[model samples]
Target: MSESHQDKQHKARQQKVKQQVDARIANATEEKGLLLVITGNGKGKSTSGFGTVTRAVGHGQQCGVAQFIKGTWENGERNVLEKLGVEFHVMATGFTWETQDKQADTEAAQALWQECKRMLSDASLDLVLFDELTYMVTFGYIELAEVIDALNHRPAHQSVIITGRGAHRQLVELADTVSEVRNVKHAFDAGIKARKGIDW
Candidate 1:
């Protein structure tokens, strides 16, 4: 009832939380690279992957990114990462909605998959970002088994981040950390078109 009483309760709760968190942190002794999957219908999947890439670059770690879908539109993250000496690769085009020519898309995705394999095998890289990789496998552009094999065989110290919607069940299960960004509401839902600098 009194303000002092409320303050005492809050402090007690804070202390309890601190103790729990500290205990968990102390128990986490094993250190190794992680396989992280960011998937869902939400818009921040690629953003989150790129954000991690920026963090890796900030740590002066070798990093590589293979953009499987996004077109040649100017990318701020790629520009900054490349400036920071990150190895970045982008395909020739983004996914196109069409009635025919699925073969072209598959071929392009296969090419990117090869690049992804190279990046995965590079022992020098501390982190690798496979942007829109889920779509590649889910859409049958690349073999899911091949993707999983590469990821599983990557260097023990190499961390990876996958971003896209509809991530394969096997990939999600293989990931040490998996986050599904839910879309409660989006600007596109509100009829607002994507804008540069904000969307990109």
Candidate 2:
């Protein structure tokens, strides 16, 4: 069979893209720890962070996770990652609206932030994930300045991932890579309850 004109055009476009990508790759030489932020009103923010932690673990790198605003429910990631030596700290207070206790939520956030600080300071850990941390900062439970300071002082080789909706502007600005997961459509909006293994 003979090649079509459309096939030739596609090949030419791909060749051009390859050259552009190759040039960018050649120009990039620096290597260091990165701060990544995953924020928006969509689902899967924490899931994405956990996926990154899993990737690091696969590489035999030490990782830590601090989950804020999450209820004291069973966590599949914690169960698997802990066995791989990843330290995890859960707020265990659930959502703020559910608890409806400002004082207690603040107290829990502070305690969890302290644990996060320890993880950030640990040079042995290659990656640290702060899941749903934006709520704490926005709710005034944790100082944004303190979070920024801790991130700034973290070891040069330690990468960090922050996942939550409504991330602080300052935090977004500081992040090397920022991704916003927009909610186009969700099963919950259609009256579908969140499943255990899939949703959690």
Give the total clashing residue pairs for model 1. 0
Q: Where does candidate 2 stray beyond 4 Å?
A: 1-5
- Model 1: per-residue Cα lDDT over 130-179, one tens digit each: 99999888778899999999998999999999999999999999999999
Which RMSD values do the candidates have, in order? Answer: 2.2, 1.3
Model 2: per-residue Cα lDDT over 1-200, one tens digit each = 98899999999999999999999999999889999999999989999999999999999999999999889788999989999999999999888899999999999999999999999899999999999999999999999999999999999999999999999999999999999999999999999998989888
lDDT of each: 0.89, 0.96
As a whole number from 0 to 100, the lDDT of residue 29 in candidate 2 is 93
Where model 1 places Cα greater than 4 Å from the true spot, the runs are 1-3, 98-100
Identify the candidate with maximal TM-score: 2
Task: Judge candidate 1 at residue 187 and give its lDDT.
Answer: 93
**Pairs that clash in candidate 2:** none
Candidate 2, residue 166: how far the Cα is off, in Å: 0.4
